[model samples]
Target: MTKRSEVHWRVSEFESGQPFIVMEQYAGDELDLFKKFIGFDLPDGTSLDEAKQIRDLLSRKLIRVSET
Candidate 1:
């Protein structure tokens, strides 16, 4: 599929662990509408500075932020 979609990340927690969520949503597409977010794990030794950097990187790669 040669389709492109905007994406964003939201910080979320599941149970007692913090997870980063990557969400992708189609803007205007027929018969191919899809929305999903997959959580990422911050493994041991991941520092706050690193997480912040990742967050910033995601922000730069995003088209816009949307609440779900």
Candidate 2:
């Protein structure tokens, strides 16, 4: 009934049906973060909303680093 439960079920289904695709997704996210240092853009499937979410999260950081 909870969202966590739903996500667990979906992950289980994914693991059972096509583990390779899920592995690829995890790898891709890691690669994306690494590529950020070189100014590589987010993947094509990333939406404006997601970009806004990432920007909002990054802007909230209080560390005051110039990397962003």
Candidate 3:
């Protein structure tokens, strides 16, 4: 991920067995991002590392927006 990046993870059955969109996880302050993800009501037992991984994966999957 780059500066000012975010992990916009949509809830998928494959990822979290849900059918909803996870909020955009702004880059920096990863701890805060994870806290937000947890609040989204992810499947029970989702760990901090799992949340981080989800964000990392999303940061890669999404298209890179050029910083103006």
Candidate 4:
């Protein structure tokens, strides 16, 4: 028996020039997996301060997810 568990994270950009973070989870087999989006869309000319805040939030979410 194989006990498999994994989590994948990625960033994707759309043609409209917005970026979003995607998270995927896998257990046992590729067929048994789930995906979710963080819903933080960054557009062109985003402010540095705002970017920093988003980064912090993303880090927190990543940490929480990794703990599961």
User: What overall lDDT goes with each candidate model?
Assistant: 0.54, 0.29, 0.51, 0.52
lDDT of 1 by residue, 1-68 (tens): 44555555555545555444444553533224344345567775565566667767776877644443
Runs in model 4 lying further than 4 Å from the true structure: 1-5, 26-68
TM-score of each: 0.51, 0.34, 0.36, 0.38
Q: Clashes in model 1: which pairs?
A: none
Ranking by TM-score: 1, 4, 3, 2
Between prediction 1 and prediction 3, the one with superior lDDT is: 1
TM-score of 4: 0.38
Between candidates 1 and 4, which one is better according to lDDT?
A: 1
In terms of TM-score, the best-performing candidate is 1
| Model 4 agreement with the true structure over 13-34: per-residue lDDT tens digits | 5666555555555333442234
Per-residue lDDT of model 3, residues 1-68, tens digit only: 33344445654433544433365654643443355443255566666567667756765787332232
Question: Which ten residues in a row are the worst by lDDT in model 2?
Answer: 2-11
What C-alpha lDDT does candidate 2 achieve relative to the native structure? 0.29
* Candidate 3 error regions (>4 Å): 1-22, 25-40, 64-68
RMSD of 4: 6.2
